[model samples]
Target: MHHDVPLIATVAMAFVLAFAFGFLANRLRLPPLVGYLVAGVMAGPFSPGFVADAALSAQLAEMGVILLMFGVGLHFSAGDLMAVRWVAIPGAVGQILVATLMGVGLAMAWGWSLGAGVVFGLSLSVASTVVLLRALEERNALATPNGRIAVGWLIVEDLAMVLTLVLLPAFAELLGGHADGHGTATGGGLLWSILLTLGKVAAFVALAVMLGPKLVPWLLRQVARTGSRELFTLSVLAVALGIAYGSATIFGVSFALGAFFAGVVLSESDFSHRAAADSLPLQDAFAILFFVSVGMLFDPFVLVEQPLKVLAVLLVITLGKSLAAFAIVQLLGYPVGTALTVSASLAQIGEFSFILAGLGLSMGLLPEEGQDLILAGALLSITLNSVCFMGADWLRERGRARFPAWFDEFGKDRQLGLQGQLDELRRKSQAREEARSLQITSLIERFPIFADLDQAGREDLLMLFRPRTAQPGERIIRVGDRPDAAYFITSGTVLVRVSGQDIRLGPGEFFGEMALLSGRRRTADVTALDYCQFQTLEQRDFRQFVSHHPELRQKLLELVRQRTEMNRQAAAAQAEPVPALPAQG
Candidate 1:
């Protein structure tokens, strides 16, 4: 009973505490993320209860970071980002600069080193992806123009943070921290180290861009063809983990960067949606672990011992950053409402802050207090993030009432143009989806045999169908040819000549299956009577599909029996023709 099971114990306790706190947080009308952090605090070494293994928690948390970043990359849309780039790119960068300077000033007042100040400032600059998305969703603004700007703003911050993570280690020694494998070099030597790091990252990106799209998608398609859900899921995990590990080991890049690129590459594949859906649960679970582990690093004493320091960090996150974002958006000629929404959205730090703090602490660039302050800021800001949204809304309503002309005149034309572009994009996306749905619907409506299958089965059948067309007099099947596929006529007619008898198949009818079912060559020649359209199901797919749906298989078998009897009677009558001719003479 005393066997060493730290992994199991840590995982089990983390989840249990997370659930309890998460449920409580939900009932309190706060984000469940708040509860997850509380759970981590309860299980942390700083707390009095049973402590989880610190090392094990850290590794699990690392995996959480990887999966979290991967999810980010998977959902990254270039078109969406481009739509709001004019406001988002500048606004986010400006806010980051203002927030970082504020944090650095605070750190200096506390007698911390410049390196510590830089790391601290950077940590407070970015907002939590989960918190902002959830807030937007709760307000039903996720699909709105303001929501798009906020999301695009967050993406810029994430990209900046990724580059910082890559370059931080290279300059760690120059920043007065212990070098992490990059030897302490001054002047040109330091420059070379930075260049080397950038070079490696570039190389890795190049390889990922070139090979990943080709290999990863091919591998996924192969696994998908197996019709095994578990295998497909496993393949996704393998790609995420494998690429991350490989990049870190071979290319000397960070796991976060590697995983992000992996997702970006996979996102280009047709399987991206399925891959994201299947891997979501695991990603969410690991993301929770990540939050819990970050909580464990927090020392509650910091809140009391350095109350002003914690408050200062919160100001940088919620106030300084928000004002900067507001100003930048206004300068870009956006409406006041849009500016406030973007500002409110950036008023909290989450995963990236914790990640940056942990890396800085490990490299000796940031003090323990810096990490503690970041954690405190994250908890307080996340808890208060909802209030920020409410405040923005209150201000917007008041502004609209008090200065109606100002609201109408400011950015009115620009706003309309932007809204028009967004509407067009949405219409195009919806049209594409509707077209695919219509095709599936038409297939089932035209062929009642497919009506028996459920939604998923119908979709699978659609994927298996190969569309084909033939002109009048075109031979679709030749006598004595091996049966390879069964064709369903969707338009016009096809003539099947069997044993000197001619049979016509119009829309919704099928031919060429008799040989496939009987394991023989074609017994008839099928020729198009007019221009025709068909959906052909290959022999392999047909067998597999019918095997899964026995009812459909039975129906096909019954048709085969009826056809065989009809052919037999025709042949028997042909043989008795001589007797009929003698009677006539």
Candidate 2:
């Protein structure tokens, strides 16, 4: 019925199936992106469904990439990237080189030209920004050190790809064994071409620096003052799209790169968060469309027709790239968890790969089969990357439990081993002290008992605390014991047994305070259920603190009374007691 309206039909089918598959994927505890790809497949001409307009879908997907990169630039800070620069820079470049070599090797074995191999290899070397960001966002790891490393690594790869895209055509004859209609570039010509490309890129950067800071912020401010949310959102879109198109048309920069710069320029403004929030829905919608567009390009028959070849490509993309990344990260003295996260985040290829392959085919450097194989590889790797993350996490946890001795044994035994060991010990000690201080400060800020204390007072109180750790099943406090200390949990879980009742406490929670304030024996037993880290305040320190701050005594007395009433109310609200479980040793 809607056949005449191809664009409308396509958009409608894409969204409808995307939602259906997204819901199904969610039910199965998978990323909804998987479902969006499936929706694309269903709506594609290859499947027996209402075929969507592939051209229109691709254009919309481009918008998705623009918005997605813009959002990433908004959250990404130079400081965060620099924090992991040592590992990220070398690691990303090294991994790309390794992956490219692997791809070239594969292509040579398949009897393809070196040019085709370079393009194929380069395509597979870079990870998809969308996929990596989505994975990190899902795990809530985007702000973590490892996430920063992964993101920085991605930026490096993108830069490398951009350079490759610029240089490939100039060196086509040397690589492909034949030149296109354009005259072959001599050595001098190649050098000149490279220099020209760099000049243009530098000019773009210069332009951005000159105008972006003042102009972008001013435009956003004007839009903000209009008191119209719609106008503000429209302005953000206009800037993103306008800059992207301008970069591509005038500066020869890619749309994704342009949009990223636009976002970076806007990020300096105070309204950046608001802009991000406003653009989120559109960003998400287009992102799904982007995945769908990629899916529509996939031909499922490749898996059946060239099973071994496709499998080999997938292995190179998923395992080859990941192993290189993992090795590079670990070699830099980062923890196994960080290495795993970085590696898993990069075990797939996407947008850039498609672009590279398309260009290669157009230049007659790549075969149709090469493009098909690349697409198939992208699909398989994206699918398996999710499992790769789960596997890495599992391995990390297993390593922590099974091989603690071997974990910290690396990156030592150099000429400065003694100094390095001393420095390591100092860092660990400082970290522990800082953790305890933060825990104490948080407790002071949160509880009514310490509410009267100012920030300085809390800082003074922090000195009375010391860090402590307890293994699972260890008894930290026993009922009826007169311990002259109070404990506040900093990490992990503890089980509290009181008057035949069991209560679980987690980080920032306190115990032994009631007994300390009441001047009596402990009323409950506290036992660690996991590897717990906490802070302990000793009786002597507490007494000294009270002596210096006499007003705290009155506040403490009032807190004790309030706690007593609350505990009484809690007990009254409890149901009939169940049989007590046997205590763990």
Candidate 3:
């Protein structure tokens, strides 16, 4: 059954295979990228010839990487990254330097050529952009101080990538010492080649930025008008691939860079979030292809023959990058602990590193086996990074001391309201303890009462209202002697009987305020409707707490006057009605 297959058939085959592997990866709690890589390996040169069109696969994979980077740029806002520029700049640069040095040293010891060692070492310094951003978003940490610093640091990495993309090829070509440098078409000689490369980058960025605003937004607006998800997807795909091609062919720059710039321009608009949500499926499809293409580059034989070397390289990528990032963030003035914790979020090889290595191998800077090592290293690092993201909360809990004060309640500013925040958290912590205590009969929460309260206010309120829970049939309050305290229903319902007339009251509906405000005895009886909960505030506590929020000075008198008038009218009618009835009789 082995026969020639058309390009379409092979591509369709890759998609189906990619999906199946991605599904398995999810079930195993691993990153889908890993599965895609694994799928590519199975279909690669060393395995069965499921895909005969290597060139076509490579093209689509290139598109996939560009789109992935573009998506990254759109998701991040420049203002957010700018806030932590001071720390992010030096921290990211320092990590890159340290990781590269470690990588180069290890590669040299493993008998890799100086040129290949340089390429491999630099690759180790690169962290997975896809994984890092995804991890930050998942943890709701993107808005946290730590997340902000980490994202700024990531931007530094991306800028470095741009420079690296330009320089690495130049370095590799120099290493070959051959005038042709593996036959990459040069516009002229060495000077001309360097100038052309630099010019392409400049022109591509300038043009893409200038035109992207008009083109991308308009295209999306049209797709949005159609309201067809399929069209939106197709438009997204065309934008990514079309722009990538223009950069590579016309501008003579890196397509990845073009895609990234395109994303940046589009990010400044309102539709950025919408674009991210709607086009996610398309990105996933191509990104999987890109990852699998990376895996296909890995050679199992290389790892087996040099397990120690392979593992060492992997170690340098993971631990060395992590440590360097941690140290750098501290040196940049962030607390040592916060820096290290954030660095853990970025200690992996990125998808773009493989692109660089693949280009290096084709251009003769890196050996094929070195490429294999990179592919495997990327897989291991990405897998580990995903695990790190998944368990970050657990990690933070266990190693809270090692992180910044920013994660703690005391670390941040007083924006969320101190007493209220702490009290809320404490309540959540002791929910079970406060669940069954019957010291208080009734409880209620009214937004109006808490409108002026901060976290501290809530804590103060909790102090006033000793919380209690009641089972069904538990009597909460009785209309009798002067009520000692007013009940606030925190949750559940209660029965209210005013002069034996029943009225149902639920959460947020407070009764007995009339007695408390008027200095009168209880006018109604209240009882829990079901398994109920409440917080009771004593009369003295209510006065003290309420005075601080809005001192009763004049408003309290007004409220009292209104209540008195209503009660007087009701009482007069009740008394006079009896006389009228007697006259009628």
Candidate 4:
């Protein structure tokens, strides 16, 4: 007699194989997602090894989609979505339309049904949020302007897909596809189905927006106060899974949509950052399983049986979509760098494509062969996207180097319009800075030297100071470097090391003054303890200020004398021997 243990066996094999393959892929400088998918194929029924429960894997994959969408919502807000709307909204939607049309043309060539063509086209339209984010993060470009546009474009695609998932069932007949279990609805039935679906979606969004924002954050805070790391992690998971299930059960919304709204509601909270951190590991585990599940559904024979068909699909996804984006961004007057970055970012499809394919297959709108082709295209595009990015980077660097003068002129001309807008922003920022400097100058007046200065004299002194910034662990001043200016700490701390001594300096402290006055190299290494902002008075500026203020000049000399004597004494103390140690011995 055999023990029935499908769940344990499948999970165990999936994890083991995924780890081995993922490690190898990373070692080869490839994305581990490729490895995970390969692992799934090996464990799938199509391959020779132990096959996982297909049904169970599908359910797990759905959970991954839900959580991944939720994570997107958690990190993004309406403001963020709107920030790049000028490019992202039109760019993403237009690219999708173009890609879908290209896919339709390919499907027509293959003599597939309109329903199959629509499904296939949709499957190629959207890029994987996970893959795109990972790619941008790897290149340290996620915080750049192009990255923001890419992310915003992704949000639009996600929202569109969520809408498609909801309506696909209601409009199944129109698309020449069957509805789920129930027969296809038409006329009044179709109208009712559409209204009901829309109503449920609206209700879920309303409830989540109204109640979830308050309750979820409060609940998370309460869990946090319990001071148990395990409980906090559990709470985060519970919120994601519970809200997802409830939305689907009570409101008839898809799990992915529900979870996305749940995350959006929670994103409003101050504790959302911690919540994201707590949920990361669980999210990652499910994401890996998700890729594995997609792999399990893929039939490798599709590549051999229909090589040209698969190539056509890959072209639509990688080339068609990328070209559309590049053209759209360029038309919007962005530089070539921004256009290439956005274009390259969209050259791969993954999670969303898998979801769309699965849905279409379940609805009988897409065939098994179609699903296999989609999976094949996704794999190839993802692998090749790396190569595409490397190429883009090379061209960008070489273009800048080889045609520096030409590129400079071209870049300047392109930036002329942006420069005007930037100038307005700069003026506003300068006004704010001047206000802040006025406050600082008032504080400076409390010092003995500045007390003698009249209002105009103090204003003149402020004009001589220029702002400087340093990041944590940055060396602001190195030993043996000739000093040009003395720095006045405005905020944060710095550590100054001279001869074997370390001195901590806080706001209101100053440094490099002795070097500036004496025309000598710096004796100490000054490093920022944290992000720091300071103001500097150059030697020339200081001398000019002192020339007009003899009393302040005398005060500075006196302080310098005192500091020099203090340093001498400290050095003598450090050199002194410990004579009393003999008595202890």
The number of the candidate with the highest TM-score is 1
Q: Could you give candidate 2's per-residue lDDT for residues 68-132 as a string of tens digits? A: 87887676566545555677789988998999999999999999988889988998898888789
Model 4 lowest lDDT segment of ten: 406-415
- Which window of ten consecutive residues has the lowest lDDT sum in model 3? 436-445
Candidate number that wins on lDDT, 2 or 3: 2
Candidate 4 lDDT over 447-537, as tens digits, reads 4457777654565566467799999999999999988888888789999987667889988778888887677898889999999988888
Please tell me which model should have the higher lDDT, number 1 or number 3.
1
Question: lDDT by residue for model 3 over 342-433, one digit each (tens)?
Answer: 76777678776887787777766677878888887887877788665545546566666665464454323432333244345446536634
Model 4, residue 383: what's the lDDT?
Answer: 79
Top-lDDT structure, candidate number: 1
Stretches > 4 Å off in candidate 4: 1-3, 398-585
RMSD of 2: 18.3
Ten-residue region with minimum lDDT total, candidate 1? 576-585
User: Relative to the true structure, how large is the alpha-carbon lDDT of every model?
Assistant: 0.89, 0.79, 0.69, 0.82
Superposed model 2: Cα runs more than 4 Å off = 1-3, 169-174, 177-183, 409-585
Error of 1 at 247 (Å): 2.0
Better of 2 and 3 by TM-score: 2
Distance from true location, Cα of 311 in model 3, Å = 1.1
